[model samples]
Every structure is written in C-alpha cells, then in structure tokens.
Target: MGKSGSAGPLMTLDINRFNGVPLHLQISEALRKAVSNGQLQGGERLPSTRSLAGDWSVSRNTVLQVFETLISEGYLEARVGDGTYVKRQVLGDFTATSATDERPLETKASYPFRGLSQRGKALIAHRLGGLTERPTLFMPDVPDLQAFPIRSWLRLMNEVSGRLKGDILVNVSNAGYEPLRDAIAQHLRTARGMMVESRQVIITTGSQQSLDLLARLLVDRGDPVWLEEPGYVGARAALMANGCSVLPIPTDEEGINIDLGRSKFPTPRMVLVSPSRHYPLGGTLSAERREELLDLSRTTGAWILEDDYDCEFRYRGQPFAALQSVDRDGRVVSIGTFSKTLLPSFRLGFVVVPIDLADDFAKARAVIDRHAPIMEQMVLAEFMHRGLYSAHIRRMRSLYAERQAAMLQLLDETLSYTPPEFECAGGMHFVLPFKEGVDDTAVAHELWKDRIVSRPLSMYFSGRRKCSGLLLGFAAFRAEDILAAGKHLAGLGDLIRRND
Candidate 1:
C-alpha cells in the first residue's frame, strides 16, 4: 500500500475491522470529521481512490464509494486529469486558515454578516397572527377534517395512480394539470357563475400564494393597494410582503366602502377584497357597492382581486355569484381555495386572471415553484369531474350550518352573550364585537391559555378603526363540543371583567 502520486501527502486513518460498523460509513464519518475540523483543508488534493484503498487495506470500490458520497455532499470534488480535492469555498474560508493555528477556530465567527432585504423585513414584520393547527375549541378557518370523504378520495387516488402514464407523470403544464384547470373552470362556471376558460385558471399552492403572486405581478414596491379593514390578515401580510403600501379602507354593513378607499388612496394600483362574503365581519358587498367598485376599477385602471373564499358554505337564501361574473371590463382576478371546503393540507387553490394577464401569471408561477404536485391535481380533477366535490361540499355545508346555529344558541344560553347584529349566512367563523374599553386581544389570549383558540378581531385590522372582538369558529367542532366549550366560556366573564 503506497501513495499513487507525489502531489499529495501521506495520511493515516484509524480503522477498526471488528467494530461492527460498516467500513464505508466509518470512512465517510472520518472524512467528514476531518473536513469539519479543518484537518482536510479546502483545495488540498486527496490521494487517488486506488492508493487510498491500498493504504487502508480496502477494495478500490470502497474508497470510490466514500469519495462519491463526499463529492455528492459538496465536501469533496474531483478534477479531470488532476485528482480528488477538498471542495473550495464550500464552507467559506475553512481551508484558508491553517489547521496548525495556535488559536482555536471560532466557528460562530464564520457566520456571514448579512441582513434581510427591505421586502424581507416587511414580510417578517407582518405576522399572520393566528393559532396553530391544534384542534382547539373555536379555532377559525379549520374545516371538519374527519368529515372529508377520504374513502372516495382514496379510491379516486388509486384509480388515478393506476392510470397515470408517461405523459401524465412527466408532462405537466406550468399553469397546472390541464384536466384540473378544466375541472376548476367548470366548477366555477356552475357554482359561482363565473365566466372563465381553463386557460385563465392558474393553479397555486393556496390562497396565500395566489395573493403573493398577484402582489408580485400586479404591483411594484411602494405602489398603493387598498385592503378591507378588519379583513383577512393573510391578504394584508402578502401585500405588505411585496412592499405594497397597503391602505386600509373601512367596511360597513355593506362590504368595503369604495367611496372611502377612493377618498384616502385615490388611485391605488390594486385592491384586494372579499366581496362574496366579507371575512371576519361577514357582510356581502351590496349590489351598489359592487357596481361602484367595478366602476372604480374601470375608471382608474385598478385591478380588483375578488377573494370568493368560503362562498360554498352559504346558509342563506342563495349563494351570490362572484364579482368577476359581473365584471365585463376584465379587471377582476377571482381567487378560490379548497382549504375551507376540503382539508387545508390539500394546498390547492386557483386564480382566474384576466385573459391578458394569464400568460404572465403562469410564467411567474413557473418561476415560483414550477407547479403544484401533479398526482394530487389529477386526483382532484377526477374528484370534481365525478361530482364528488359538489356532494362533499353540500354535506359539509349542511353540517356546518347546524353547528353554527347550535354554537350561536349555546353561547346565548350559556353566557347570556348575544350580538344584536351578526351575519348568519356563510363563513366558517363569526365575530363577537365588544363595547369600547374591552381588551379583546387580552380576552383572546386568556381564552387561548384555557385551550380555546379564539382570535382577536382587532388583530385583523392595521388601520386606526380597530374593532375589539373575538372571532370564534364553529365549522370544525360538533354541536356538543361547542356547547361544552360554551360552558367554559361562560365562566370567563371574570377574566373579561378583569381585562375591562
């Protein structure tokens, strides 16, 4: 066993034949430690695999395997006509410092001194401010996961999996799976009365991604965008993350006040609104306000983003058509997600952009994540095409309607707390407004401490017109569970009194 060339120094490696460890693993670990401890300096040529194998009394394949592992992990590199060398700059200047230095290496000092960009700082500061996925009582935005049609879904998944061919697996359009886009387009046309072609449907990871995409593609940094006050925190966060100057417009019994938005930010580049059913506050945009908002978009060249989320669960007279259905000017970008209807883990949502913007949005989406998983998209397309999606939605809608009524009644009975005015239509959650001087955030925190996950309504607002209240969800829990939680909620009056 000897060195293969005169270019590299001879080295000793400790090997135990009877240590019960695989030689390959021991060799890899030893090399890793050596590199980490600066024993193997960066750019230092290593002995040929043949020579190392001879020196260690191992096969050439073993040395080759070890080298391959380190090379794949970026710890080592092989140069043609030269030899295997420790990778340079893989972990900064670890090679530049001599291994025989008198002082010990300050590992922490090697960290790069960098700061987040302006947009990154903005994103970090704008917290979505909500609870975790814990199945706590009164948690908002969580669907009844147990009630989802898993058996049917699994059957469809299997069928799709079996039928997936080379084209289905390897070939995917950047927008999404074409069949899934067709399914979404058809569903929107039938359910929400939207006029959309499959080409306009750009599938996204979820509603958050949709918002972020819109923020990125439509507006630039410091551009003005109007948001509904006491609205969805997620939309606000996404807009701010893109460095959009978010101007909060107030909402009333009617949806967003178009007049106020115009008065404050006269010409914002875009406006994100939940016109079908205002989130948290739960008010559909009045017909007049819809017209006014559309007119504003047409007049000022502003793009209106209609978040028609949770419109599938309306318990009222009839579900309203999406605002885009009435927009003849092609200014509306309709967004929908299955998170509230199906499970949130599905991570499937779609954005229906104007025909002119569709190409750019798809290109941008391709850059963001290439596209969502094709297998799930195929299964969902099959699920929708077979009419299972509608049936599941109808079942969950009915069930949540019952739970909503039961929760409202139980809250009244248990705590003698009933809002004089509240929207009893669609939406997974409802807001209970407190009078002035009550610390709703403190109340929410206290309830959370007791395992009740209620959100402070004030947390949804960034403007001066903050509403103090709690947003309690009823869609995820049973009537009995809500009542049981209501019993605990009844005793929390002392805490509210203390906060007051």
Candidate 2:
C-alpha cells in the first residue's frame, strides 16, 4: 500500500523553475495545501521521498528537501523507526475526512463566453505581417537570394564563432551586442547622415518588433496619431492594436502633404513616416516638408517615428538624408532594418531613441524578450566591422539597378498592354497604376491566376481616396526573368481587359 489514499489517485505536482518561484518552495506549498485542505488526513503516513519523487517527476533529493522544510514547519512529521507522516497538530486544524469525501479538482471548466479587450479586437480587425510566407513572382520587398554574399557571410560567421568566449555567449544585453550597435551607429553616420551613438540603439527582431515596441512604450489608448495615406500597413496595424486613434494624412509625389496634415489634424501624439524613401509608392519626403514636420514636432510635442526601410536601394542621384538628422530636439525615433538590405530571415533591426529614453527602452525590451540571439548579433557585428556589409550592399545595389531598368524596359516594350505610370526614383518595388475606375485588387487576383504575385496598391490605403495600382517588385528577379514575367503579364492583360 503506497501512501496515496485508495479513494483518490496519487497526488500530482508540476515543477517548473521558470515560473519565478523556487522549486523547493513550490513543492512545499503544494504538499502543505494537501494537508490544510483535509486532502491528507491526520496521522496519515505520507509517501516516501523516493515515491513522491517518482510521482512528481522530480529528483529524490528535491523531494527530501521539500519534506524536510514542511516537517520543520510542523506540517509534516518524521519518525525514526518508520517513514514520514502528516503532523497531527497541523491536521487537527482541519476535519479528518477521507479523500472520497472531497470533490476532485477539475483542470478545466466551461464558462459563459466574454468578449475580448478593445485592443484585442483592434488587433483582430487590422491583421498585419506574414507578407513573405507564400512568396511568388513580383512579391514586393523580397531580397535576391541568388545575389547574397553567402560565402563572405559564412566566413565571417566562422571567424566570429572561433573567437567567441563564455562571457560573449552568456552576457547578452537587452540593448544588444555593444559592438553591433557601434557598427550600426557608424554606418548610419555615413549612410543616412544621422548623428547617433551606440548607446541609443536598441536592437529588435525586425521592423515589426520596432513598431510594436514604440506602440507599447509611447502610444496611449485613444491618443491621436498621424499616419500617411497609402502608408505601410504594418505601422497602421501596430498603432491601432495599441488603441491609438489613427489619422491618415494624404500623400503626393513629394511624399506626405504636411500642410494638409496640419489643416486636418493639427496636433497628434505621434507621427510615423518613411521619410528617406516611402514604401510601395517610393517617394522621398521633400526637404521643405521635412522642415515642416520637424517644426510641427517641435510645436506640438508629438513624437516622430522615421522608418528608414530600404533607403539604401536608391538608384537615382544622391538619396535624401534621414529626417531624424534634422530633428535637433530628440523627438524623433529613427528605425532601420537589415531585413531589406540583408536577408529577412536575419531578423535584425535597430531603433535610435533620444538619449534620455534609452535606459527606459532597454528595460522595457528586457521585460518583453530578453534580447535577440547573441551569436547572430556577434556575426553581423563582425560582418560590418570588417566592411563586408558595405561591400555586399554596393553589389546588391548594382544588381538591383539592372533589374529595375529591365523591369521598366519590359513594361515599356510589351505591346499588348499599357505600362503603369510611376514618379518615384527608387525602392525595391515600383508602383504600376491602372485606370481610375479599374479595381487593381481584381487585376492583382487575376495576375495571381497566372502565378504572378503582386500586391495591390489599394491594400495599403486606409482612407477614402484610395488609388488603384499594383506594386511590382523588381529587386529579386533577373533581367531575363523580369522580361518573362512581363510577357505573362502582357498575355493576361488582354484576357483581363476582355473580361472588364
């Protein structure tokens, strides 16, 4: 006869140290509850430490320690000639009853349904991310896998790993690997003309994570925030999920209309912009507009989030400097991602915050997820430190320039259809606008039937004056491939036009 009562099954205990309580204390508390609740009767012989160890899936020494602790507190007793038993004095506080007299605890129960929180509902309503899962031809924002410098990257990884020590492996900081932050800061100084320091950089998993962190840290529920019309969907979704009242400001050839934004929603708590090069539409925010936005930030005390995604792929004359470079008042948070320049799977990005907010953001990041993988950070740091990162970017830039030209050439040469109009100088994808009345979403779906995947421009807009177009990615495809894709598109154009 084991110590377990016949009327009930053996006691079950789950031990996980990650629950923030010590292992011994958790076990002691569970056993104490069994005694106090009359589940274990007075003078009832308890299971041996070995028996309890087997049942609880814990070490015998751990169970013995728990037993020792409980015995010292008078909840359990030990007899020299026999095994341990429940202390009569402790059990006397409760009525002596068989285990059968007490109802068994149910792990689960049915209850009336309740609604989710408002934020939960907002998140559900505006779903984002997962854009790269089923990548097809012309999928926007995808890097050329064939052109990546895998050999150089692998060599750098080997070099970094060979020199790695215990301290580097275990001493991961919430701010990120210091050397990597330094590398990013140095790169940004020359690349985007931003005066930043390593300490202000907070490494995140991706741009999506950067957005989420900013939403959690700065945005308050129901606070009005300015977002560009036909803007990045991920930004809108993140802000909405945090319960921000999003104000969609319209855009033009020179980027977001600052005067219109001022007229419509003069004061917002936050404003998110892709200033260096806007996504999908591919417009650089004009210098005058940049000054206006900085002035607005200064006057209203509204925070400006500059998403400098894909700023390196500019094929035109010198690309504009980052908007953060002009904000002397530390109100701008500049975000950049290696996901566009490097592989998205790398999952590395950084946010440069004001020096005053650095420590708080670091603490907040630690509470969210400790930090990004240490080894990857080390490898990338070495990659950049050795100048391989800049070299890779230059190579990809040349290759992408060729691909972009090829796509444009094919669109112009294809005789069966009219080429879409474009005004932007650079980005990974080019906007292909359709007639005003045509639904680009339907055209994109029809193109998908021919295995050509392109994002509809209308999908990015959240306002009434939505444009109709397709965002065709050229950076990932070769010249020959782009021409082939154009042929398929031209062939499908007639069918689509006939149906229309």
Per TM-score, the best of the predicted structures is: 1
Q: Distance (Å) between predicted and true CA of 336, model 1?
A: 0.8
Which lDDT tens digits does candidate 2 get at residues 1-500? 53342222378776786989988889888777778767777688876677777787779899889988888777888888577888776733444455555666633344346567777887767543323344568888889887788998888888888867877777878999999999999999998899899999999998989998998999898999999888988888889998899999998767889899999999999999988777767777888899999999999999999997988888777888888787899999988889888886879898999999999999999999989988799889989988989999999999998988887787667733333233436678877766566777777777777778788788898888887877888888888888877666774343322212
In angstroms, the error of model 1 at 177 is 0.5
- The residue pairs that clash in candidate 1, if any, are none
Q: Please report how far candidate 1 places residue 63 from its true position, in Å.
A: 10
Report how far off residue 320 is in candidate 2 (Å): 0.9
lDDT of 2: 0.81
lDDT (Cα atoms) of all candidates against the true structure? 0.84, 0.81
Give the per-residue lDDT of model 1 (tens digit) for 406-483: 887876787665543437877888777676667887887778777888888888889876767778889999988888
Candidate 1, residue 220: Cα displacement in angstroms equals: 1.8
Provide the lDDT at 414 for model 1.
72
TM-score of each: 0.79, 0.75
